[model samples]
Structures are given as structure tokens and as C-alpha cells.
Target: MYELKTKENDRSVVEFIENVESPTKREDAYKLLDIFTETTGYQAKMWGPSIIGFGSYHYKYPTGHEGDAPLVGFSPRKAKISLYFATGDTKREELLENFGKHTTGKACVYINKLADVDVAVLKRLIEQSVRFLQDTYPNNNTN
Candidate 1:
């Protein structure tokens, strides 16, 4: 059985943000916290040691692998901020076209700062991610 390392925990999100070494990253973490919260309409929770996540969903793959994951989340990392959104959404690729400056990986979109991206587009990405996960995993508790 494979274990999920990013499981949600009881750690304080505010305390995590305040402890961010970079003042700029700390400020950006706060900004992202507000954006994810208002957009998802779900309170933020700490995922693992670094990710500030909103909402959650339980997923079981056809291969019998199952785990819970956040609907959306972000981490203020050393090099760039990582934005976690649902993968396999075509709409996500389309939205990234107008999302200002950012780089995408399989599950994370990296950005230098919130100022470098359009906040409105970021909100839409968050909403789309939540909707995609809820629709894809209908029985999962995504809220």
C-alpha cells in the first residue's frame, strides 16, 4: 500500500505563514490564504508541513489506491510559490493562457509572486479546480 504524505493535519495555518523565513513569501502566503479562502468558500487547513489547503476530497483510483487531498492549495517555497489545483481539467490549460506569468507542472502551478499574476484568474482557477474535483469525484466530500 502506498501512503499519502500530504495528508491534512491540525497544524495552525497562521503559525505556519508567520514562520515563513522570507518576509515577502510570508506576505504572499497571507495573500494566497485570503484568495483561496474567499474563492473556495472553505476555511484553510494545513496540509503536511507546508501546504495551506482549502476544502478536501477523498479519491480512490481504479488500481485501489485511495487518499484524501485538498481541492486547492498553495505553498510559498524557496524559489517560487506552488499553486495546487486539480489536474486533467482542459479548462485549466485554457485559463492559464490568461493567467499572467506562471509555470505549470503535473499538479502545481509555480509563480514568483501574486503580483506577477492576475488575481481574478487565480480565483477562477481555484473555483474550477474545486468544481472539477467535486464533479469527478461526486461521492467524495469535496467541501
Candidate 2:
């Protein structure tokens, strides 16, 4: 089980964004971080080394393998941005259609830039993903 940290050092996350070499990327990351914070209403957090996470949730499956995972999060990678959608693959195709040009793994959505996507749709997707995860697992760990 992944131990969930109640508090995070927001400064570290901001510092990581500030240190990005590309000026444009850095500025845009800050802007999106603002949007993410406003949209999710969950304080931003640094998950692991790079992922800037929003709220968090706890999961336990039939096998008893469970852990604390962020409700929604994203990372500004060198090649592209990665959004974590902790939900199923049922609505994956539908969301991709309107989410603009992007790629997807089992649960991660990749976008080259914010300019290529709709902020509203992205926010909705994150909101939906968080809700789904919350509903799927009654024992949510947001503290």
C-alpha cells in the first residue's frame, strides 16, 4: 500500500515548474497549474518525483493490494504532457474524440500542448475521473 502523505510541499512543486529551461513551457505549466487548482478545487501536490497531483483517493481490490493514489494529476514531461485519469476504459474513446488530438495508454492521457486541447473538456474529464474513482471505492482518502 502506498502511504498517503497528508500535506505536501507546494513550493517544491512550483520550484520544479520554475526550473524548466523552456520559458514558454514553464509559463504555460504555471498557467495550467493554476487552472488545475481552480478546476479541481484540490490543492496541488507533488506525487513521487514529477507528477503534480490534485486530490487523492485510496483503492483496495479483491486481492487486498491497495494504495493511496491521487484523484487526478498531470506531469509536464520533456516530450509531452501526461494526465492521469484514474478510471476505466469505457468512455476512453468518446472522451478522446472531443479532447482534441491526444494519445492514451491504459489510464494516462498524453497531450503535446495545452493549445491542442480544450481546457473545459480536460477539466470535465478530470472531474469525471475523480468522481468515478470515488464512487468505485467508497473509502476515499482525501485528507
The reply for model 1, stretches above 4 Å from the true place, is: none
For model 2 the local lDDT of residue 14 reads 87
> Using Cα atoms with residue i matched to residue i, what is each candidate's TM-score against the true structure?
0.97, 0.86
Per-residue alpha-carbon lDDT of candidate 2 for residues 75-137, written as tens digits (9 for 90 to 100): 888888888886574665677689998998877898888898988888778777777787887
| Colliding residue pairs in candidate 2 | none
Give me the candidate number with maximum lDDT: 1
lDDT of 2 at 44: 86
- For model 1, how does the per-residue alpha-carbon lDDT over 25-123 read when each residue is reduced to its tens digit? 999999999889889899999999999989999988898899999989999999999999998899999999999999988789999988999999999
For candidate 1, the per-residue lDDT at 18 reads 90
RMSD each, Å: 0.9, 2.8
